[model samples]
Target: MLFGASDSYSADEKMQITVAFTRFGKNLVQRMPRVRFGFVHVVNNDYRHWIMSAIGGSSHPTIISHGNRFRAPRNIAAKEVCKREYATEQEWKNWDWRSEGDLMLNGAIFTQSGDPKAAKKFGGYRMIAYKPAHMVPLLVRWSGTLECRPNKPC
Candidate 1:
């Protein structure tokens, strides 16, 4: 989960938080290769709004779906799924992940692509096509949990 205040963050802070999250994601993926779906908790309204805005305004196509058991922002869930035809250096400049928004290590789920049905089972879950990248930065001033689940039938 991601936690932060409703207040705005400077660009530098955002960058730092992104780096931290990237590191955390990398470690988590290394330790748990089976991870396919992940959850981010936002505790602050301002930060939450920012995240929602960013995701909503993202250049990528995002799908707004219904929320199930998970407590998603605004009682709704969002996801962006796309295929990665080629790898770009700009996408992996600060990390080994495939894209800037990708949080997965190898850009594949369970060492390969994931099933869309499996991803849809989770509320607010993302089974992105390009591996999870360019996630909104988790503010250092906030607190939250990053929960991950294996690529199993949910």
Candidate 2:
């Protein structure tokens, strides 16, 4: 059996904490056992920035699983994309700034760190854009039974 959980975040506010959970049952097939994985799916441009910042700065085994579907309009100047798309400068200020695209997903094997505090130092909006008072935590949790009997499985 496969189990999963999901959550959403807002672009205007820093995501104080985000978590993902998964459960797995013993594999019935003789093929290689599947390991639990976590994914962070971002919808809007702002959400994408936050997620990317977290993944890029994290020391964990996180990686970009899928990229955005929309590419920047090459015909327009690079700086114009945000100004035209967003109504206010404030809305576009904290954005990823580098590229103009939407939709993103980052994946990592769920492994809890002994030091939860380590997350604070990781590269993310909490460190870059927000002040200490506005900081937040992004946590991913994975748990499940593995094919290895009586052995520790990740």
Candidate 3:
């Protein structure tokens, strides 16, 4: 349920938003049939990649089958939207997640190895984002949730 006025974003920005929503919708309708209804709120221009990834990879049958549920962006192409560089020395690793800005679009759903045949038409996806103000702290919480998910073999 992405929200925002056309005036808030440039024309180019809308393209990405459209793509994300479409892909998510397509995936849910086709793959997850359990969804009864969903909602979204696009607070601002801010984007959250980790949250989107979690929604995409969710193994829960309810999430997979539900036809209507607002998840993260789908076909988003990652860009160094925000970057901070280190100066002078060898630069150990000047990375800042707080300042790192990226967009995670609901891209075309595909089967692992980048195969078009595996692409699924979920339809235009939607987003409900919090402003950068809200996102900053939310990311920290999101990270914690992801850590417990267990991505490796237990």
Candidate 4:
């Protein structure tokens, strides 16, 4: 579940996305929703399972992650929750990717970079009222229209 452009990265695209009160898990190939060439606000989501990083992006996308839960997989090497594509550490270290009020579990780590005031710059209006990261499970308990019975047949 990726958002925005794939390779053609540019701020001129003016693409922006806000994901709130959702659940992200069971993804192995990529992040929950990697964005590119825009601003993305990922707030108040449950992340219980993921082989790769929970949130990832590239091409200088401004990622503002707040009040989300990230539970890393058993693999110790895959505990980091932020990944940059097609950029080296020196180049990606300047990207605006900030994580605030997020709950990390099972050695989950978020490599935040760029300016700390970036969130306040992009987050202008308060459209939705979301709970803290600890309450993500309760907020996103029942998503979709189907009965999601874990460890059992749906």
Query: What lDDT would each prediction earn against the true structure?
Result: 0.22, 0.23, 0.24, 0.80
Give candidate 2's TM-score.
0.16
- TM-score each candidate: 0.20, 0.16, 0.17, 0.86
lDDT (10s digit) by residue, model 3, range 1-154: 3223322233322232211222222222221111111222212222333222222211111111112123344445422222112222232122111111223334422112112221122223533322343343343333222344467852
Across 33-151, the per-residue lDDT of candidate 1 in tens digits comes to 11112222111111221112122111111122111011122312221212222234343122111212223221222111223343344334333222122333433324345565698
Best by the lDDT measure: 4
TM-score: the better of candidates 2 and 3? 3
Ranking by TM-score: 4, 1, 3, 2
Estimate, for each residue in 122-148, the C-alpha lDDT of model 4 and write its tens digit. Answer: 655832444788888888888646777
**Which segments of model 4 are wrong by more than 4 Å?**
9-12, 126-129, 145-154
Candidate 3 ranges with C-alpha deviation above 4 Å: 1-35, 42-129, 133-138, 145-154
Clashes of each: 13, 2, 29, 0
lDDT of 3: 0.24
| Tens digit per residue, CA lDDT, model 2, 1-154 | 1112212222312222222222111221211111112222221211111211222211111112112222222222221111212124443232232221223223312212233333334446532222121111111122335468565763
Worst lDDT window (10 residues) for model 3?
A: 57-66
Off by over 4 Å in 2: 1-66, 78-154
Q: Give the worst 10-residue stretch by lDDT in candidate 2.
A: 27-36
